[model samples]
Target: MPVSLTIIPELNLVHIIYSGQVTPKELFEETQACYQRPEYKPGMAEVSDFFQVTSFEIGYDEVHEFTSRSKSTHGGVDIGTDICLVGSTKVSEPAILMYEGMIAAKEIPIRLHVLPGYPEALAVLNLPEDSLKYFPEGCHTERHLL
Candidate 1:
């Protein structure tokens, strides 16, 4: 299956769901399409679920380009990844490298989060599961006073 990217501005997050069948090139293309919306500016933060990815790595050039573009177009970027059994074991290493690359190239801060799963990712975003009362299977249904 092709990778899919979902951006939820209201939640201030971007979610990338990959099926492990696509190449990084395809993934980046899809990501660009998702962010091409006029309303999407630079500085958007995102969370990625690579649970379905069989194996992957971000090359140095790719990392530099991504971080540079994000910083120049957006204010900064945060990338969160699932650290469960199916995700990246070298998550922290890449995250730090990407962050440093971004800082050095564009002076942008790229934040990284290594989460166990969706619930943990949401928790890191402060959108805990307890916040909702009746959301769908993976959504928060709790009511909040906005």
Candidate 2:
């Protein structure tokens, strides 16, 4: 799979890492599957890392539709969650901006941040500085990866 999901329940964080060439179907399917996992919580913060993604095949319609469905699953009158996007200018900026636009248009109350890498994402989420020091290489058993 080009996409992998890692949920760190203790930190109320979920990291979705994408690599190689990715399609809209693969991306959304992995995300929806992640939502169905037992470890997923409604308000948990998300770090969507598109750093290694060489190509992201998505567009306005796909993002809009996903955001619409996502609103039903993650929107309400309560406090919203944070979503940090780890991406690069060439590969993922357009899609990130589109998703941001959708969220804003729908007024879903999700705080989205676009950062360069994992360190920045950790800072935005207010997590420990060293939280992902050994990530994607060596991780604790507590982190459930799918």
**Model 1: how far is 74 from its true place, Å?**
2.2
Backbone atom clashes (below 3 Å) for every candidate: 13, 0
- Prediction 2 TM-score vs. true: 0.87
Q: What's the lDDT of the predicted structure labeled candidate 1?
A: 0.54
Candidates' C-alpha lDDT: 0.54, 0.80
Residue 114 deviation, candidate 2, in Å? 0.4
Q: lDDT winner among the candidates? A: 2
Score residue 6 of candidate 1 by CA lDDT: 65
Find the 10 residues in a row with the least total lDDT in model 1: 79-88
lDDT (C-alpha) at residue 77 in model 2: 29
Judged by lDDT against the true structure, how good is candidate 2? 0.80
